[model samples]
Target: MAEIISDLRQDDVEDTVPGGIAADRLRSIIERIEKLEEERKARGDDISQVFAEAKGAGFDVKAIKQLLRIRKQTTEEVEQLENLVDLYRHALGM
Candidate 1:
């Protein structure tokens, strides 16, 4: 998919938006997105570092990661997930 996109020709490029936005506006939007993507990569690295440190401190990193994931969900969502897990476990005779 990426290879196909990278192979796009100059003639294949067209301003599809109504009124055809300015090139400068398009360039600015792309630059902003690139910047945010770089920041996101950095944040992901930082998160990995934190997880490594937790493991080094003799913490159960896997359980801690699960707790962090569950904390991000709403109460109703967590209940639903738990219910699904219980149902699946029971079905498998676990």
Candidate 2:
């Protein structure tokens, strides 16, 4: 499986949202994020760093990480179900 980088960490030039964030505020956020990433990486991707940074930012670390995990979907092992669905609905005339 390939490791993924969050969209927030990407370097795309286009603004994904329409009439999006003001340049100055966006830049500030990016700079802070860079510092956060540096702090995270310095600790070798220790998740505790995420909590620590969130804490320093005056945000709830535990809740934020929990929210980040709420919508994750793993598509890695769905091949068998997909094949079965196709086999019944298409191939087998059910």
TM-score of 1: 0.65
Which portions of model 1 show Cα errors greater than 4 Å? 1-21
* Per-residue lDDT of model 1, residues 1-94, tens digit only: 4564445445435742454344555677799999999999999999999999999999999999899999999999999999999999999999
lDDT, candidate 1, residue 3?
Answer: 60
Local distance difference test, each candidate = 0.81, 0.64
Model 2 poorest 10 in a row by lDDT: 1-10
Q: Identify the leading candidate in terms of TM-score.
A: 1
The TM-score, computed over Cα atoms with residue i paired to residue i, of candidate 2 is 0.27
Give the per-residue lDDT digits (tens) of candidate 2, residues 25-48.
467888999999999787876777
Model 2 stretches with alpha carbons more than 4 Å out: 1-45, 74-94
Residue 77 of model 1 has an lDDT of 100
Question: For model 2, what is the error of residue 76's alpha carbon versus the real structure, in angstroms, after optimal superposition?
Answer: 17
